[model samples]
Target chain A: MKMPGFDISLVIIWALVAVLVVLAWRRGEGRLQRGLRRGFEMFLINGPRVVVALLAAGFLSYFLPKALIAEWLGHESGWQGILIGSAVGPFFPGGPLVIFPVLVALLKAGAGLPSVFAFLTSASVWGVHRIIMFEIPMMGPRFAAARMIASLALPPLSGLMAVLVIRLLGAPAGVIP
Target chain B: MNALKRKKASLLSEIFGVPFWVFAAISLVMGVLTWQLRGPATVEAAVMGDIDLFLFLVPRMLGGMLIAGLVQVVLPPEVVAKWVGAESGFRGLLIATVVGALTPGGPMTSFPIVVAFYMSGADRGALVAYITAWSLIGFQRFMIWELPLLGPEVALYRVLSVFWMPVLAGFIARRLTIWTAPPPSEEGTR
Candidate 1:
C-alpha cells in the first residue's frame, strides 16, 4: 500500500514556505512580491542556461558510461561504499532531475540499494557546489580539504544509518535485507 | 553602438559564459555518459514533455524563494539584536540546523537567510552548517518527488542525514573558520 503521510509532509514544506513568504510580503508590502517575481523572471530568462546545464549533465553522464563509474570505484561493504561514493560520486554529479530517473533505471538493471543511496546523496553533496561557492573565495585549501575529508565520512555512515533505521522501524522484513 | 555590443557581450559572458568549471568538469567526465517541462493540452505535452519537470521545479523553487524573501522580512534587524539569535557554539549550531532543515527555499534563498541569521547574531559555524544542510538535504524536496519514489525507508534516512550534517558541519566549521555568513544586507534577507 502507498504511504499516507508523504503528501502531508510535502505540504508542510510548501505551507511553511508560503507562510514565511506571506509574512515577509505583508511586512514589506509589494517589495516581497517584486523580488520573487524578479527571481521567477530570471528563471524564465535563464531558460537556456538551466536547460544546457541539465542537458550537459545528461549528455556527459551518458558519455562517461555508468559501468565505468561503477567499475572504477564500486564496493560492497558499507564503509567502502561510502568512501568510494564520496570520492567518485561528485565526478558524476547531477541534481535530482537526472539522478532519480537514472537510478530507477539502474535499479531495474539490478543495482543494489546501498550503492544507489550512496551514489544519490553524493551526487548532490560532494560535487561542484563545494567548488563553486564554498571553495577558493570562502574557504581556502585547508578548509576545503577539511570539508571534503569530513564529507568522505558521510557515505558509509549514511549506509550504516539506513540499515539500522530500517531494521528499527521494522521495514517489511525483506524491505532492507 | 559597437561599445554597446561589447558591453552586452561582456555582460552575457559574466552571466552565462563563465561556467562552473568543476560542474562542467564533472558533467563532462560523466557526459562522456548519461541523462523538465509541462502542461495539459496534447500539443503542449508533446512539445514540452521532459521540460515539465523543470516547469514543476520552477514553481516549487519560486515558492521556496518567495518564502525565503518573506523570512528575511519577518526577522528584522532590530528584533534580532534584542531577541533570540543564534549565538555561538553548540546552541548556535542547534538553531542553525533547525533553520536549515525547516526553511523551504533553495540555496539561493536559504543562503541569504543564513546570513540574515548571522548578522542578527548567528555564529559563523551555525551559518556554515545551515547553508550546508539547507542545500544538501532539502526536506521539502523529499516530500514532493523523492520520498514517493525513494520510499519511506530511504526518505527517513535522508531526513536523518539532515539532522546530523549540520552538527558535523558546525563543529568542523568552528574549528576551521572556512565559512561565510550569508549577506544580511540583501534586502530580501532584511
Candidate 2:
C-alpha cells in the first residue's frame, strides 16, 4: 500500500510550524532555539512509545474480528443492537480504513442506524487500543481515565438519540458496499 | 562522575517507561503469534507496513511538537489560564469545543497541542472538551470520511444529535478532576 508521507495533513502541520517559528522569532531568537530544543526533547521522550504503540496496533489489526462483528450486529436492531454496538466498538481497532468499511458491511447487512452511530461514537471515543497506545502514554493516566469516565455514557446516549432522530426524520439510505 | 552517568542512563530509560515496555511486550507476543498463526511473510509485511506508517507520521508529529513548544514560549500563560483555566467555566468549555472541532489531523497533531495547553494553564475540563470535540465532531473527519462514505443525511443527523457531547464531557471531566486527585501539568509517564 502507498504511504501518505507528504499529504495535505503534513503540509498543514508544517505550515503551522512555520507560523509558530515566526512567532517564536519575534519573541526572541533564543526562544526559537529553546522551542526547537524542547520539541527535540519531546521527540526523544515520546518517540519510542509512539513507535511501539504503532507496532502493537499494526500487529493487532490483523486479528480484528470483522466477521464476528458483522455476525453480532448484522441482524440485530434497537436497544440490543445499540448495546452490542457500544460493547463492540473498542475492540474494532485501526483508523478510518478499518472502521468505515466495517460500518459499511454492517449497514449493508441490515444493521440499524442507531447501532452503527453508537458503534462509531464509542469506537472513536472509547477506543481501547488508542487509550493504551496513545492517550495514556501521551496525555497521562489521569487525563485518560477522567476522559474515559466522562465520556462513558456517550455511546449509548448517542445511540438513543439516533433512535429519536430516525423516528422524526427517518434513516438515511444504506451505503454502496 | 558516576552519579552523573547514572542519572543520564536513568533519564534515557525513564523516557521509555512502563507503557513502552508493556507495548514492547505486547508487540513481541503478537509477533510470535503472527509468525505462528499466519506466517513469517505476514510478520514481515506487518513490520514493513508499520514502519511506513511510522515514517509518514514522524514529520507531522515533529511539526506538532514544534508548534506546541513554540506556543508554550510565545503564548502568555495568563492568557491561556484566563481563557481555559479552571475559572474559565462554561465559556471556556465553549471555546474549547469550537477549537477542538476545528482542529484537523490525527492524535499526533492534537495530543501535542493538548500537552502545550495543559502546560500553559488550561484546565482539565477544557482539555477534555477539546479532545472530545476533536474526536466526535472534527470537521475534517466529518467532511472527508463521513460525508463521502455514509452520505449527507446520516452524517448530518449523527452530528446534530451529538453536537453537545464535548461540552457535556468537559463538564463532567471538570467536576471529576476536582473530585479526584489533581493531574500534574508535566508529561506523565503513567
Candidate 3:
C-alpha cells in the first residue's frame, strides 16, 4: 500500500490540461502557441517561489499541534470561544480528512456552535499556510493582502451570527450524533 | 557603491519579486531547524515529498496558464467586463460567488481562472467574491469531503452559519479598491 505521491487529483489535472489544449488548438496554432509560451514564462518566474513555499509548508506542517485541537477549541462558547476558534483555525493543518474528524471530536465534547462556525470560517478564509503555499505564489502578494484585509471581519461576525441563529431556531447546542 | 547595490537589488526583485526572498529565508531557516531537530531522515522525506508535489504542480500549472491565456484570446473582453467588471456591481458579485462554488479541483485550477478573468477585465470585487466563495462554500468540497465525514446535521448548521461571507467580502473589496490606488504591477500577469 501507499503509493507515496500519485492521486486522483493528478488525473483530474491531466484531463483538464488535455481539454484546455484542445480548446486552444481549436482556436488556432497562433493562440495555442501564445498561451503555451505565456504559461511557460509564468512558470519560470513563479516556479522558484512555489518551490520555496512548498518547502516552508512541509516544515511548518511538522509543527502543527494536532493534540491541542480539543483543548483549545472544545471548551467555552460565545465571544471567548469564538475568538479562540478563529485564532486556532489557521493553525490546524491539512484538508477535510485531516480536519473534519477533529471537528467531530470538538462537537462531541460539547464545543459551542458559534465557536465551531468561527473556527471553520477562519480556516477557510485565513488558512495562512495555504495562503503562503498556494495563493501567494499563484496570485501574488497585493491580491492576497487585499483579500486578507477585506475579510478580517468575517470570522467573528460569522460566529456572532451563528449564536443568533442557534438561539432563534432553538437547535441543540452540541453533540450532533 | 549605493547605486550598484540598488541595481543589484532591482535585478533580484525583477526576477523573483519581494515575497520570494521573504519565503526563501523562511524556507532556509525552517529546513535547517527541521534537519537538526527531527533528524535528516525527516528532512529527506519532506524534501522528497516536496519534489513529488513540484512534479505534480508542473503539469497543473502549465494547463492553468494555458487556460488563462486561451480564455483571454477566446472570450471577448466585453462579455467578461459586462458580467464581472468593476461596474457590474452586486450582480457581478453574485455571479462570481456562484461560479466560485461551481469551480472544481484545487487552488491550481481556481487561481488560473481568476487570473484569466482579471486580465479579461473582471472587477476586483467579483474576483474577491469568487475567491471567497471558492474557499468558503466550494460545493465539490462539501459533496466529496464534508458530508461524508461530518454528517448532515453539522454540515447543515455550518452552511447556515457562514453562507453570506462571499457577497460581504466582495462588497468590502469593491469599496476598498475604490479608496486605494492599486500599484501598476498589481494588474494580472504581464
Candidate 4:
C-alpha cells in the first residue's frame, strides 16, 4: 500500500507554490506580503480543526474492525450495502484525508464499487457537518437547502452507475478479495 | 469600508463556528473510545500516527492555502463576475463548473470564494454549479486524495460517472428559480 505517486505529487505541489509565491511578489509592493500573511492566517485558523479531525479518523480506523466492515460492505451484500454506505456517508464527519483512508480500508476489507461509490458521493454532496459548518453559514440557508434538495438523488444515482460500470468492466472480481 | 467590516465579522464567526467545537468533541470522544477498546498503548500509537500524518499534511496544506490566497488576489473580481455573473447565463454556469473543479483547497477556503462571487453579482445557478462541481469532482481532491488512495481505475470511473452532475444541478437550480419567481404584474404592483 505504498503510494509512489505521493512523493512526486508533493514535489509538484511545492513547485507550484514556489511559482505562485514568485508571481505574487512580482505583482507589486505589499501584494506578496499580504498574500503570504493571509495564507499563513488560513493555515493557523485551520490547523486545530485539521489536527482533531485526523486524530478522530485515526481512532475510527482502529475502532472499526476490518472483518465487520468486510461482512457488511462486501460485494455479495448487494444494493443493501450501497444503501447502508450512503446512509453512513454524510455522518462520517471528516475531510478527504480522513475519508479516503477509511474508504481504502473498506475496499481492502472487501467492499464493492457500488457501496464505495455511494458512500463517497453521499459524503461529498450532503455531508451534514459540512452543511452546517460551511454551507449554511457561507452560502446562506436558502441556497444550501436548495442545492441539497436538488442533489438529493445523487448518491443512489452514483451507486447505480457504479454497479453498471462494474458489470460492464467486470470490476471488483479481481480487484478486491 | 463596509465590506471590510462585514468580512471581519464573518471571519470572526468562522473562527468560532460549530465546526471547531464539533471536531474537538468528536476527537475527544473517539480518543476515549479507542482508549477503552484498545487500551492506552493503542491510543498512544494512534496519536503518534496522527502526528506523522500531520507532518506530511502541514506543508501541503500551507501550500494549498498559499495558492488559494494568490489566486484570490490575482483574479480580479470583475473578471470572475464577467464569467460567472448573472449576465453570463449558461456560459456562466459552465465557467463556474470549470473554475470550481480547478480551485484548490477544501470547503473552508472555497465557500468564502463562492460568497465573494455572490457579492460580485454571480448568478445563483453559477454558484450552485460551482459548489456542486467542487464537492463532486474538484481536480485537486481527486489528484491528491482519490487517485492515490483508490487507484486510477476507480477514480477514473467515479469521475466519469459524476461528470455531468454539476452542470445538470446548475441547470435545474436555474429553472427552479425561474419557476418560483413572482409574476411581472405582481412585481410591478409591489
User: Using Cα atoms with residue i matched to residue i, what is each candidate's TM-score against the true structure?
Assistant: 0.59, 0.58, 0.56, 0.72
Q: Model 3: residues >4 Å from true position, as ranges?
A: A1-76, A172-177, B1-87, B179-190
Candidates 2 and 3 compared: the better one by lDDT is: 2
Candidate scoring better on DockQ of 1 and 4: 4
Q: For residues B107-175, what per-residue lDDT tens digits would candidate 3 score against the true structure?
A: 777777777776666677788898899888886566444543344565677788778889999888877
True contacts kept of each: 0.24, 0.64, 0.50, 0.57
Task: Report the candidate with higher lDDT, 1 versus 4.
Answer: 4
Q: Could you give candidate 2's per-residue lDDT for residues A1-177 as a string of tens digits?
A: 436445555566678789988889988959999888777666676578767766766677677665664455543446787899999998877655457646654665556677888899999889888788888898788789999999999999988998788778765655312
C-alpha lDDT of candidate 3 relative to the true structure: 0.68
Model 4 regions more than 4 Å off: A1-6, A92-113, A128-146, A160-177, B1-29, B76-78, B86-90, B102-124, B139-158, B175-179, B182-190
lDDT of 2 at A153: 95
What TM-score does structure 1 among the candidates reach? 0.59
In angstroms, how far off is A10's CA in candidate 2?
0.9
Alpha-carbon error at B95 in model 1, in Å? 1.5
The CA lDDT at A131 in model 1 is: 51
**Which residue pairs collide in model 3, if any?**
none
Tens digit per residue, CA lDDT, model 2, B1-190: 9998997797788788886788789889989999999999999998998787567666756776676567657765444444554445788889888878866557877787788777666778888888899888876566445654455577888987799999999999888865565656532111
Candidate 3 C-alpha lDDT tens digits along A1-177: 123344454455456557767887897848777766655555566567667776776676665553454455443445777898888888865554335535554664556678887888888888887889877887688778888888898889878887777677766533432
Q: What is the lDDT of residue A27 in candidate 3?
A: 75
Candidate 3 chain B — worst ten consecutive residues by lDDT sum?
Answer: B181-190
Q: Looking at candidate 1, what TM-score does chain B attain?
A: 0.49
